[model samples]
Target: MKPRPLDGITVISLEHAVAAPFASRQLADLGARVIKVERPGVGDFARAYDTRVKGEASHFVWTNRSKESLTLDLKNPDALAVLMDLLKNADVLLQNLAPGAAARMGLSFEALHEKHPRLIVCDISGYGDNGPYRD
Candidate 1:
């Protein structure tokens, strides 16, 4: 069989709610290696949004299918170190965290550009990263 377009691509996704996860799922469908980063124990809050499908959140399943998941408490130094290590080799970094959250943690494009010059960073937010409504 022929290799898919994104066969060797790796995506690190720090996402929740809907948009980012859905986008990454599409990438995963196209054969990217999508590693979804979740909170240590609670995971994505959407997991509790519904249990309509035999005790599982249909939304979560739909948005997260075909991807690997990892638990990382970004607050922990070791966990942050691990994320940094992943970024060093990742092809894309996709996140939909609250505005400025990723930047505060130094995951912003400007922050990672010099080190991972080829890494593609995608930040999805309902509102733009700046302005009064960007919370």
Candidate 2:
């Protein structure tokens, strides 16, 4: 099989549940580095959606292989600072948050791009970022 085109990119994902996690994992399978950022204590909610696999959430293991997990509470100043430091080298930022969540945390594409001209941001939402249902 052909290696995927994103072989050298690094993806940082602020995601929960399913959609974004699935995509980011596929990226990692194809040689990308995926850093999954979750909140402290709770982690990704999907991790507890069920315990159907070896005492772990089936969804969690399936979409989180070959990736690094980091606990971050963006609302926390110290954590935000650490995340900002990481953006210094991130090639891509992938997020699937509730409406306006990214911007609320000051992690919007426009915000990050002002500093890193080459950083790519993909905002995943139940609805597209600016369509009906957008915040």
Candidate 3:
């Protein structure tokens, strides 16, 4: 078989809800490694949407396939350290965290670009950064 285009790529996503997970699923389908970062103890809120898939949420099952899930509390120093280490070698960082959440965790493109120059950071939010609605 031929190698997939994204066979050697790695993506780390701090996501919730549908959009970001959907995007990461596409990358995973293309053969990239996707690591989903969720809140410890709670995991992704989407996981609780409904148990329509053999006791699993249908939406969660659809958008989370072919990826790995990692629970982390970004507020914790050790967890933050783990994330920073992961970012060191990650090809891409995709996050759809609540408004200003990523920035609060120092995961913004501007903050991470210097340390991980080649890292591609994609922030998906309803409001763009620095806009009047940006919270």
TM-score of each prediction: 0.93, 0.88, 0.92
What does the lDDT read for residue 126 in candidate 2? 67
Question: Ten-residue segment with the worst summed lDDT in candidate 1?
Answer: 126-135
Name the regions of candidate 1 deviating beyond 4 angstroms: 131-133
**Residue 54 error for model 1, in Å?**
3.8
Candidate-wise lDDT, in order: 0.94, 0.87, 0.93
Which number leads on TM-score?
Answer: 1
Q: How well is each residue in 12-124 modelled by candidate 3, as lDDT tens digits?
A: 99988887999999999999999999998989999899999988799999999999999999999999999999999999999988777888889999999999999999988
Q: For candidate 2, write residues 1-135 as lDDT tens digits.
A: 677877878888998888789889988988888999999999999899789988779879898888899999899899999988888888999989897888888888778888988998888776776876675
Give the better candidate number (1 or 2) by TM-score. 1
TM-score of 1: 0.93
Model 1 Cα lDDT, one tens digit per residue, 89-111: 89999999998889999999999
- Model 1 has how many clashing residue pairs? 0
Q: Each model's RMSD to truth, in Å? A: 1.4, 2.3, 1.8
Best-fitting candidate, measured by lDDT?
1
